[model samples]
Target: MKKTLTGIFSGLAILIFILSIGLMISGTIALRRNEPVFVFGRAVAVVPTDSMVGNEPDSLDVNDMVIIRKATIDEVEIGDVIVFQGVNGSGNPILVIHRVVDIQDEGIITKGDNNSSIDQPSYQDYVSNDNFQGIFQTKITFLKPLSQMMSSSKSLIFGGLAIVLTIMLISEVIHLVRTYQDEKNEAIKKKHEEEIEALKEKQKQEIIEEILRDNQK
Candidate 1:
């Protein structure tokens, strides 16, 4: 039972670790390609700028990780922070996250909580539901730094994971060998005891036969 539970937990840990690595790889690809990294219904992004930071409630800081979920036009109410694909000043597409301060006839107007003015009057100023990736669901304040470190030292992380898995595999093999040997030894002992009991029974029958022959003589 203990071994069974150990196997279960080990399997779960390995599965979780594999999933984390996959996410890291996918996130790296998405960031480089300027695409949204989606897991289930949510998108994950690492904050590269401090535009969202300031004296406001739930402000996001640089290097923070955020989870975003799909939002409908109706669901995008005032005060809701939204993520969208937009062109930056250099005319390159980028992901932007900001709060909705006003709903307009054409679309919604957004501004960074820390910025003094609304978004520059470009294609990015007015956002529609079609441009939306999602609304901010939650944030992981400390994960971005760790993720950056892991991404920078991928070789070291891979080596560590390999070593740990090798050790676990070796331990499992040793346990299996010891269990097999113990069972074999127990079987041999049982057989030896059975043989000795049979010998004693044969000797008792022989002695009784000898006593009967002497009485007849």
Candidate 2:
């Protein structure tokens, strides 16, 4: 029982740590990138492709963590990974993570690392700095496993963990309640026993007093 309780609490603590680190990473990036979607603009973006792998570009990996940095259109230089909003009809505000292949006076041209060629030929015209979210600067490790988890059967992963945690928490509560009730019942029983002993002592003293009165008579 002790071990189970300890394990449950320990798991919960670790999970909380994972969550806090993720939040801090994301929040810090969102703050630096000026993203209203996250508090403090410290948002993390995904490494969309492996172009940066052999390129020795920051040792980044596919699905690795990337910190977002809000910069002016002028600062969007070559080789930097930029995340931006795509055109209309895109679902859920598309976030395109691509390296800056070319920067022009009016727009930028981006390309995927693993792909055979650059993005749509119309890429240059679609580039909008006003819609830019942030540029990738650093890596965030805590989000990698979380990213994998969410990618693989997100509902099942989250639901299963939630169920397990809830069960453990509920069991702990029940165990504590039982312990408290047992202590209360034991205390009441002991109090009753003490009261009985006290009554017997009183009776003995009364009998002695009655005997003394009879002798005087």
Candidate 3:
């Protein structure tokens, strides 16, 4: 029984370690990419005060985990769900996730298929063809709980993150220590040069002192 318990615990620990490493690698890659740094780089922006709620055409719950991405028209096709900065009553600098009603060179126009009137503005001037977050991939409420894993937890979340970071930091410190030892070894070779310079300076001072003494004599 003791051995069995030990095996189960060991397995759990191994899984946890793998998960820890996975999170670290993900963070490093996303930091390089310059996209938002999320646990999975995914978000659950609550439908705050109903501003964007019911604005999405396909449908989204009051609090939904929107899977937003970065992309352009080539990536986005007709009928794909997307989120963009819309100048609607969506509460200033609004992020609206609606269907692509039409696409234009200047910008793209979208509307909540559920809403009676189309949004008030166009993204032509605002959205550069150069850069765009692709669009919302899907609307599923099931993954909502997973988003909570992206947040504060004393034991599970923060502790796991801390353990992973500590490993990286320790590796860096070991590298620096090794480098310092190498530099120290090189300095040992310079000891003879330092001694030689000191001796030369001493001889010059002695010669000057001797000349002064001879003149006095």
Candidate 4:
């Protein structure tokens, strides 16, 4: 029973490790492409700015991980926080997360919770099905901080992951070696017991022959 449970747990751990690696690889690729990572149509994003942060403790802050899902333009309403791609000062695509304050035929107006004024009208001034990714559904805190650290030093993170996988592999190898040794020991013990039993039977026969010879005399 103990061995069975151990095997079950080990299998589960390996499965989890594989899944984690897959997620990390996919997430890295998506980030490099500046795209949202969708798992079953739900997108995951790390909050890069504190624009949505407020004085409340429950408010979304920098490094908070947000899960986004696709929504139509007609489904969007005022006061809903949305993530969209916007051009930065350098004309590069950047993700912006803010709440919609007003809805217009052209586009939606957005502002940060902590900001003083609304964002200026520009190419990103309106929300459309093409540029709009989705609305934020959940906020996971503290993971963003860890993600930032990992992003800053990718080599270290990758090295650590490599080390962990190596350790797991080594552990499995050790378990196999130990199991083989145990089986080998059991076989040796069983052979020794058989030889001892054979010796005892031969002695019993010799005693019976000696008694028969005395009776014949």
lDDT of 2 by residue, 1-217 (tens): 9998899778767765665556546544543553423323344445544655645455567767566666666777888777776532333444677777877665777776665566545542346667666777677666677555544673543343343334434455557768987999999999999999999999999999999999999
Candidate 3 local lDDT, 38-83, one digit each (tens): 3333422323223334543556654455555555567776566666
To one decimal, what is the Cα RMSD in angstroms of model 2 from the true structure?
Answer: 15.7
Listed in order, each prediction's TM-score against the native is 0.55, 0.46, 0.41, 0.55
| Candidate 4 lDDT for residue 76 | 84
Q: After superposition, how far is residue 113 of candidate 2 from its true place, in Å?
A: 1.9
lDDT tens digits by residue: candidate 4, 6-27: 9967986786578567756876
Instruction: Give the alpha-carbon lDDT of every model.
Output: 0.72, 0.61, 0.54, 0.70
Please give the lDDT score at residue 87 for candidate 4: 70
Estimate the lDDT of model 3: 0.54
- Pick by lDDT: which candidate is best? 1
* Candidate 4: Cα lDDT at 193: 97
RMSD of 4: 13.8
Candidate 2 vs 3: which has more TM-score: 2
What's the TM for model 1? 0.55
Q: Ten-residue segment with the worst summed lDDT in candidate 4?
A: 157-166
Q: Enumerate residue pairs that collide in model 4.
A: 107-126
* Higher-TM-score candidate of 1 and 3: 1
